[model samples]
Target: MPENTERDWVLPTEIPFSELKGKDLEECVYWLLDAMGAKDLEWRIGGAGGGAADGGRDLEAHFFEPDEEGELRPQRWWVECKGRSGTVESQEVKEACNNALAYEGIDRLIIATNTQFSNPTRDWVKEWQRTFSRPRVQLWDRAHLERYLSRHP
Candidate 1:
């Protein structure tokens, strides 16, 4: 079992969508992102009330590398947050992966969903892991979520 922190790994039963908008989702995502040790990160929580454009990615974090401009440029780290009760479908995962591929200089794509991915989606992830050498896209389901939350909270 994953460790429990000040804030436990909440299911949809604990916190519904009505509660997880804006600051609530942002706080959760921030904890996970920090636990992941993401540097130079920027996040937008719960692609609702407007910010769902530029693909379905919830957070657009750019890990910077020194460029010729002598300034840190955004590297690809398009994060899609699915804080839903239902298991994520394969099509959504595919769409996020495709978006990551389309973005310039994205080193990786992270799909962070509160629920598990469908079996087909898990298989698809395995295939992508084998196929993609650079700019790989990976899935992080509720287990990962709980682990991170446990560490932080």
Candidate 2:
């Protein structure tokens, strides 16, 4: 198990997503991102166990990609770790999207959920992209996260 891992690991799948809740889920996401080389990560809790709100974002990360001139251009990403039993609603993502407007440098919005997103939310993101294109959206549903984690694990 990773250093931040809260429990023992099982073979094949390793950590079971269903058994995790609240902060545990957030920690898992953080660990996965850390393992994958995302830098400058901040774990922000919002309205859970009486913690102050985090403006709809759960984790924030920074990435640097070389530009055409070989300059490292910084990209900021806001990650929301949603541990849901059902499909994630659009409002949740919308809140995070809208919150991005209040910040200056956020260039990407990553919605990482234990469950899949609602169809309406997908449509909303598509529509949202057609208008404003600054913060590229990346939806890491359960299967997507599994694929990424399984490779690193």
Candidate 3:
């Protein structure tokens, strides 16, 4: 056998999703988005062991889209990371939606969770999209996140 010169890379699929919790999960989300070319990403946590005081957005990012004049307009994205073992419920989604409303200039709100989303929550998101005109809501549950990681990696 030839001498091993290449470094081994562990894909996200090899890691146990349940093992990622709280801050770790949030950081993972940041990395995933960063790999996908999102800019101005920042974790909500300020000091050591501190969380967002507002409990709204866990991460913030911006994606630029060229306007009619060829000016890159920023689309603000607010990402909320949830690392719960159980399925994410409608109440949690509702709270995120409510909190996102308070944030001005946000173009989209993304709820990123390591767990599955409840059917009701999915339906609620659909209804919310129909009712709301601004700040589109999106869900990035386990399957969705895995798909993104697979594509980006």
Candidate 4:
């Protein structure tokens, strides 16, 4: 694992995303998010092998901000991890998005994938955001994850 220090920072070359499985991939995503300042993290999808019955939520984090009363309130964010190889198509993205939207109490939904997303899937997320009032959606594909690690490390 790479540390946050600049001198210690090294982009992964040995362990490709395609090689990671189950908890390994989820832990990578969790640490990445933690490095990016996400707090109150919870791993909903554990290391135990399971299917997509997790309601499109793999992890949860809280972002604190002051409300109208000037008291800090936690804005819940749900994360869904797709660590498969090849590009994630529009249908897959739509399914994840729908599952996230259907779940309650989340202020934002983040889809983190080792594989890249299709152009149509990206466009669909943009349009979906335009139509919804809450629970904003964000996609973190391979390139995005790389960039984030580079910047934060």
Candidate 5:
């Protein structure tokens, strides 16, 4: 059978910037994952989701691909989602990179933000790309968010 039920994508311009905080951030990440065609994955809200703390790493999700033997491996990924919170700090990106190391074997580390990172943070990311560039870390800022929304709309 051929699959022909393709849906058009649309960018949402109505999502208030204020609503992308905390729990809303997790939901938005979840929606993005779904839109990206990820299925049967487990995700949880850490840090603040457990109550009150530093509200670190708002949300985390995993995406896996089968190995050569058809075994589902941890060759997955970890996502750190942050809402529009002014400019993200270099330490924040550093934290996500550190977390990815703790996860080991992850194919990628994705930091999705509804905002932009400061100059220092951007430089930090660039340096990361230059050093220990194993678990490819991708920084998705506001522009990426807008594109995702539009493509899935």
Candidate 6:
């Protein structure tokens, strides 16, 4: 065995969030969701899925939660992974939320970012949620992702 082999992959805490972006970031979120029991995970292509989505590179998965009748129903989840060097913007988050909400049968929309969201952006999400609620919104930022990494590591 090589004595000088680096274990960077095993020590993800040393890796900065900026190191992950685009498809690389999305894939990480995809695997995390898989580990957390999200079912039928697929890369979203096109806005409607099957091709490039309006959100560009994103993911789709399902979480089975108890319905009103106590039956577990599959709730579709659209995950928008943003690995940005800068803070995640308001308009971009709005667009992603609106797009997912408009899309039929999308039970939840999670905007996962490797960077912190702008204050206004977070506020806007809160306002949007107060007015329009159906597709639940979750913002998983750098801290969240880091926690996930620590748990899974």
Overall lDDT per candidate, in order of appearance: 0.67, 0.80, 0.85, 0.79, 0.69, 0.81
Model 2 alpha-carbon drift over 4 Å, by segment: 1-14, 46-51
3 or 6, greater by lDDT: 3
The per-prediction CA RMSD against the true structure, in angstroms, equals 7.5, 4.9, 2.8, 4.7, 5.5, 4.5
**Which clashing pairs does model 3 show?**
none
Could you give me the TM-score of model 2 versus the true structure? 0.83
* Maximum-lDDT candidate: 3
**Candidate 6 displacement at residue 71 in angstroms:** 2.2
**92 in model 1: Cα distance from truth in Å?**
0.4
Quality of model 2 by C-alpha lDDT: 0.80
- Which ranges in model 4 have alpha carbons more than 4 Å from their true place? 1-9, 12-15, 46-52, 65-72
Instruction: Report RMSD for candidate 4.
Output: 4.7
Residues 64-84, model 3: lDDT tens digits: 988899999999989888888
Across 19-50, the per-residue lDDT of candidate 2 in tens digits comes to 65568878888888888778898998766463
**Full ranking by TM-score:** 3, 2, 6, 4, 5, 1
Error of 1 at 42 (Å): 1.2
Off by over 4 Å in 5: 1-11, 47-75
Write model 6 residue lDDT over 1-153, tens digit each, in one string.
858976656555665678888778888888888888888889764444234544532888899999999999999898888778989878779888887765778888889998889888888999999988878888999888888877775
* Candidate 4 lDDT by residue in tens digits, 35-147: 87889998886444566456578889998878899999889988887777788767877887787767678898888888788888888989988888668888998778778
5 against 6, candidate with superior TM-score:
6
Ranking by lDDT: 3, 6, 2, 4, 5, 1
- Across 1-153, the per-residue lDDT of candidate 5 in tens digits comes to 988998854446666655676668667777887777665545665554434342334444456678899998654556677776687767778977876676556677778877787877777778877887778888887778777877875
